[model samples]
Target: MSLSARLEHHLQASGLPFEILTHRYAATALENALMAHVPGDHLAKSVLIHKEDGPMLAVLPANHQLDLSRLQSMIHHPIGLAPESELEDLFDDCSPGAAPPVGAAYDLDTIVDNSLSGLDKVWFEAGDHRTLIEMKGRDFDKLMQDAEHGSICVH
Candidate 1:
């Protein structure tokens, strides 16, 4: 089985019910809308930010942008986008455009949007452009226990 298949298998084995969506390479926001078949606001976007010490994963709504200041205060650090060159070395499973919320692959901490707590389910990349995973937001939060919940939105 391929890496993508393995990922899906792992999620299944973990008892996380999810739906996989395939697309012809759309932007993260666009991809989420396409997958949910709804407005962009209905989708959650996971943004991977790297700090001086390590990486921090930030999950936000597709319709909103990340508020770095709020994130910094919450995580207690100045976070920024991982350098293009550093991304591949640190996150081997991360493709050019697909950065999943799973931080185990990179040994980084994760922070999810507080708004996600209200949603029954959410969508995120499945390590590739052609695949997206949709699962219960609460289940995802439980799975990612180490992830901190905060305001990742730009307001």
Candidate 2:
């Protein structure tokens, strides 16, 4: 298991130390959290939503789900989930179906769910599904400080 080269470079350049945790093969973020033995609330799950302006990455806890209506209202635009085929091209450096929450690494707009702010720790896919990148919550916050923050996830 490995991180996408692009994401690895982004994390390295950010100067924030992190660790990679390997887990059993899982199909969903919740499964990943379970197999990885991490708190579901602290697992960062990324969803790619697209609109006329382009794609935006919506990040939330694995225990939560994206509230598409809320996001559409916030952005004031019609939006929908990006297709898997499109994601393969956009996140080319990563494995199919696995997306890192760090959208800046892929040059996409990003919005993080407020529920994930100010936690003790956070974990997300390593772009290879079987591995996770773990880091301090403050460090994760610093990386996403510039991204919009909102209640985009339903508890």
Candidate 3:
């Protein structure tokens, strides 16, 4: 099955209500803002980071960037963006620039920005740039229990 199909199955199995949004091309935050007619902050950004110890996934509001230093402290390791070429090996069944927020396929821990707590629901890549998945913040939290919650603000 395709990666998006697997992700759909996973969501169904988890009993989470979600909506899938598709775009003509890469559905980046900028594209999503235009498509959904919402500000960039409403879109969630999922980034894959590699640390000296291991790999981790960070989910933050599109309006903010990940604070590597803070993330390193939170995960207790020196963390940096995973090399673009290594994304496939890092996330099975997912291609480069198409990682999901759940991070289940990567078998890596995830950290979510505390700012997400204010949003009732958020949107994230559904294993592909052309697709997106929207779910409640609480549901997202439940699905990614290994995810750490913190202030990922760059300031």
By TM-score: ranked, best first: 2, 3, 1
Model 1 bad stretches (over 4 Å) = 1-10
Q: Give me the candidate number with maximum lDDT.
A: 2
Give one digit per residue, the lDDT tens place, for model 3 in 1-155: 12455566678888878887776555455565466554567577778788777777888776677888887777677778888766667655654567676766456777888787656777777776567777786777677666688988662
| Per-residue error (Å), model 2, residue 11 | 0.3
The C-alpha TM-scores of every prediction are 0.81, 0.97, 0.83
Off by over 4 Å in 3: 1-6
Best candidate, TM-score-wise? 2
Q: Show the colliding residue pairs in model 1.
A: none
For model 2, state the Cα shift of residue 30 in Å: 1.0
Which residue pairs clash in candidate 2? none
Model 1 sits at a Cα RMSD from the real structure of: 2.8
Q: Which has the better lDDT: candidate 1, or candidate 3? A: 3
lDDT of 3 at 9: 65
Displacement of residue 61 (Cα, Å) in model 3 is: 1.2
TM-score of model number 1:
0.81
lDDT of candidates 1 onward, in order: 0.67, 0.91, 0.70
